[model samples]
Target: GEAMDRRRSCGVADAVCDATDASCTEGAPEVVQTTRLYAGAIGQATAHLAETRLSWESQPRNIAIFLRRATKELIEPFEMLRDWLVSRYGVRIFVDPAAAEELVPGEATWTPEQRPHLADMIDLIITMGGDGTLLFVSSLFERSVPPVVAFNFGSLGFLTTWDFGKFRSSLTRIFEDQSHLNLRRRLHVTVVQFDEGDRPSQVSEYQVLNEVVVDRGSSPYMAGIDAYVDSQYCTTVAADGVILSTPTGSTAYSLSAGGPMVHPAVTGVLFTPISPHSLSFRPVVFPDRSVVRLQLPQSARGDAQVTLDGRVGPTLRPGDCVVVSISAFPLPCVAPLSDTHTWLASLATVLHWNDRRKQESLTSASYTETIAAARRAGEAEQAIDGGAREDGAVFDSSPTASESLDDRKTADRRRGTRRDRDKAAADGTVARSPAVARRPRHRRRAAAMEQAPELACAETIDDIESFMRHA
Candidate 1:
């Protein structure tokens, strides 16, 4: 079975005949090889502080390192990785001009302008920060992207799977054997600008991994946006903003705005409103093939800002439209050995999906006991009132009617005094006259809290069943 699985994933076009036939190889096909790599890392001072110790072993090879800026402590890891790669595999290391000046002394560097020329020779990408680093690397490539392996060195690591401890083993597996990959879809967005009495022209274009957000920037009034899907008019949204998200982005800002969570395997886009003025403006999911367009109305109170993957893009004036569709190329993300396990673990640890303190049991016996006690108290009060009325009627024509009335008054006074004493004892206060004694505030609050759940659970099973049927 293992042999068959290997042969199936061997990247060969033709099927293997038999193991003994000599043509069928045992492991991955010879076509797979990674000679040049493009490595990126988060160069923030905080990232270096978070990861105090960095150690790894790798063969020397030619690789490019991408970073914005770095501190002295953070530069050590990049230098270490570079030295390891050069010492083991005799690999030459490349870095951006700024990082090259700081970390890789005497090594050649590539500028931002030379990235397109450098992209052709890169075989794979290794990112050493968080999901943001991966997104930044994705933005660099305009065509086909090299497979990326990311390490979790940041707070939220939805994309970064591997840690520094397993970096060597993970890289060895990828370099030496067949590895599974998750193909993440990206969105292509184009902004169209219009001039007075002139045709609309393409102003800007960007490929985003997460989502495209159109929002009312610094505007106190709600944004007025017209939405369309596949050239058909959808609706005009008046809200704080609207998010158009890819499946990869469904768990990002979209999730915060009450959008549904979509599996990475799904190829659909999400349309979710941000604080919509109307409650009926619900989020909608469209097929990947559908083209979505959003335009700011002429009556809009302010200009709307278009952001791709949380980065600032073109600003949309009134009558300007933004078009979004699936891009031709998909990002090839290197999957951890246990894909589902890692994903589920991240959801629990990072996102805290279902993390909460265990709630006290709602259907406790104390609830029923409290309800029964309240009912008994109410019945006893009714009984006392009835007895008093009977006494009054019986003593109406008696010779000793005045004496009987006096006796009843004495009994009522005694009951009131006893009640006051009980209240004083419960409240840890001195016993006082009936006029001065008051009910403890906590008793009333406790009664209300106890009664609330009882009323909620008062429905019968038959009522629940009927409600379910109607629903």
Candidate 2:
């Protein structure tokens, strides 16, 4: 009603033409329109001022909805968003071929394709699944990708941080040019395959949000991969495989393969080896501009397989190589306003990075309680023992000291008995010298000393005085 009132008061409604008319194009002398308004009617396009970034002229009119799967759960939301977007704001929709039947009259179906100038065709990309769905969308456009707004539906939603519940408001903000965009770098990998003649046969290119892997798939023998950086020989990885990743992919397969977790904002490439046979083959970080290449030696026995973002690619023949570097166009993921720390939060939430059990804090109350408990324990021991000694030394008054003294007394008695038996035996039959008949007088006196009372050692001053007097 308000928009209609504004249109009526300015007489703009009188000049408005049928949005679906093929003759009425933006900047056409027939339309005579001052502002660039996107036509949301079927099979129609309006000119964009700013191409990809969110701005007044870059408002998303043709939004492509990509889902992780064609399940009922995702299809329902797809239809709901389609209805809400078209009915309220007259936004055109593009959907997957699987969900084409659910499209309304004005809404259109979208098919994924490998187009270079896709941004010129579509204004925005809205993904309704997990990070994998977003990766699939990223893989669609080789260059000039539109801004993507991803909603979390799958598990481990590190990349898909936006909630579907607040999608309406998010889309509103995006249309109003008020939403924040998290731009993540992607790796562009080109694989050049060679034939037996050592000549280039085929070249395949891919855009990966995660790591590109070259591994010995199902092969018992180790893979011998020669790695290089910017045309300089780096090292040969003799292991299961090697992974080249972007900083955005650092936390993914590369990290699992013993690669360092580089921040997404960092402009670097990660070279990680998977179970390398050599102990010295460690993960290395190369500049973003540096082109890292992985190749199989010509003397290789088995072919090494290549995988880009978990999708299997062509096997690399002997002398074949893969070139990896930063992509030209970065992926603009829609996140919360000022939520640049979402990646850090994902590290803690999803990956459980640096997660540890919190230790007990030492507070004054706890310390005092511990001291009181120790004092009470000492008091209980004192009650059991009758009283403590006046000596300042702890070992002297402790029960352990008394128990040890008893042990010494018992030991002395055993020694005395053994000596007395050995002496009494005529043939020295008590496991002693067989030739000895009787022991010496000094030996007998020593045995008597060993058989003395618990106070024999004069452990205390009073015991010493009493022993001297008795002697």
Candidate 3:
């Protein structure tokens, strides 16, 4: 009874006792009202933007809706953006002509002739689904290019940049025109074959945003492969096959096959060996503009399977060659408007750099401390860069002096040739001025030399001269 009375006096709720009053005693003071902080900044910002007016009439924007075909999970993300846009800017949502009516039904207007093909009508393309969906959308455009923003739904996606937990903030930022753009390289592939009588057949081409691989098609025998770069022999690979991948794809199959993890912004191709016989045959990176060719030996014992991105291509028989080169265009990916270093930082953080033992070494450190350390390191890097600039001034000046010396040499060469021409003209040996002699030098020589041979007669000589002038 004493304990119960004490608990009641203190306004403490006991497990065995039932009470529903602000104060334990009738005359006791009521508890003071207090508020708690809410970590819903993104949610609140998104709601605020939904209610605000959009400036599209004066700003005039083009929008794209990207969704996955297999999962159909991006409907919510798309609808959220769609409703917000209609409520604010009165922007119409366009869909694929064949799939528009059946897939997307809304208050937005559409025209048949002006179908939104992602590559055509839309200024920006939004991808909803996994990395596969992103790849599918990226494969649509052939020549002209547009930017894409991918909301990830795939597992282990290197291409998708958005996090599900922070999507609310990401969406709000994008809608408010506060985001970054990450650029990536793409590869173009062409498939060719011979007709029944050995004549060249029709050509089929594919554009891939990732990689193109050629390997033995589940055959028991090893693939006979020969590779060339710029018509120069690189190597004749005798392995499962070869993978010609872009920097973006280096983290895909290339990485699995012992290739480096290249950043998407890097302009290069990763030539990764897929299960090579030779230990010395390691992966190599070539300049972005290099043209790589893979050929199957005529005496090859097996047929080769070619894969573009993940799709399979026709089997390549002996004597067949696959040519690969970088495309003239690039794929523009949308990201948060942050420092470029953030991408690498995200990879390192998410992947957990160093090793398990090293990570355990820092287990006691707070996350805040780690972040502060990173920031301090960044500042140190800036200071080092400034020092490099100051120290490199003399090194930079040397290049200018070298360039001036080359320019002087060129000028002296020109001046000496002009003086030689002037001296020759004064001696009456070569009467043409330097400028006249320089003009059409080859053409004048050709005109004098191209005359048809004379028949050792005046009449033949006259006819030959006439023919040379006319020719």
Best by TM-score: 2
lDDT for model 2, on a 0 to 1 scale? 0.67
User: Each model's TM-score?
Assistant: 0.63, 0.65, 0.58
* Model 3, span 44-119: residue lDDT tens: 2321211222111123256666666644455566677677766776656654432344456553434644432334
| Candidates sorted by TM-score, best first | 2, 1, 3
Going through the candidates in the order shown, the clash numbers are: 6, 0, 3
lDDT of 3: 0.60
Q: Determine which window of 10 residues in candidate 1 has minimal summed lDDT.
A: 46-55
Question: Model 2 over residues 83-192: C-alpha lDDT tens digits?
Answer: 89998788777765545554332446644552443555566778888878888887876654566788899887878888889878877877776765555778889999
Clashing pairs in model 3? 179-337, 180-336, 180-337
Task: Name the better of 1 and 3 by TM-score.
Answer: 1
Clashing pairs in 1: 59-89, 60-85, 60-88, 60-89, 60-91, 61-91
Deviation of model 2 at 420, angstroms: 43
Better of 2 and 3 by lDDT: 2
Model 2 bad stretches (over 4 Å): 1-54, 101-107, 111-117, 364-471
Q: Judged by lDDT relative to the true structure, which candidate is superior, 1 or 3?
A: 1
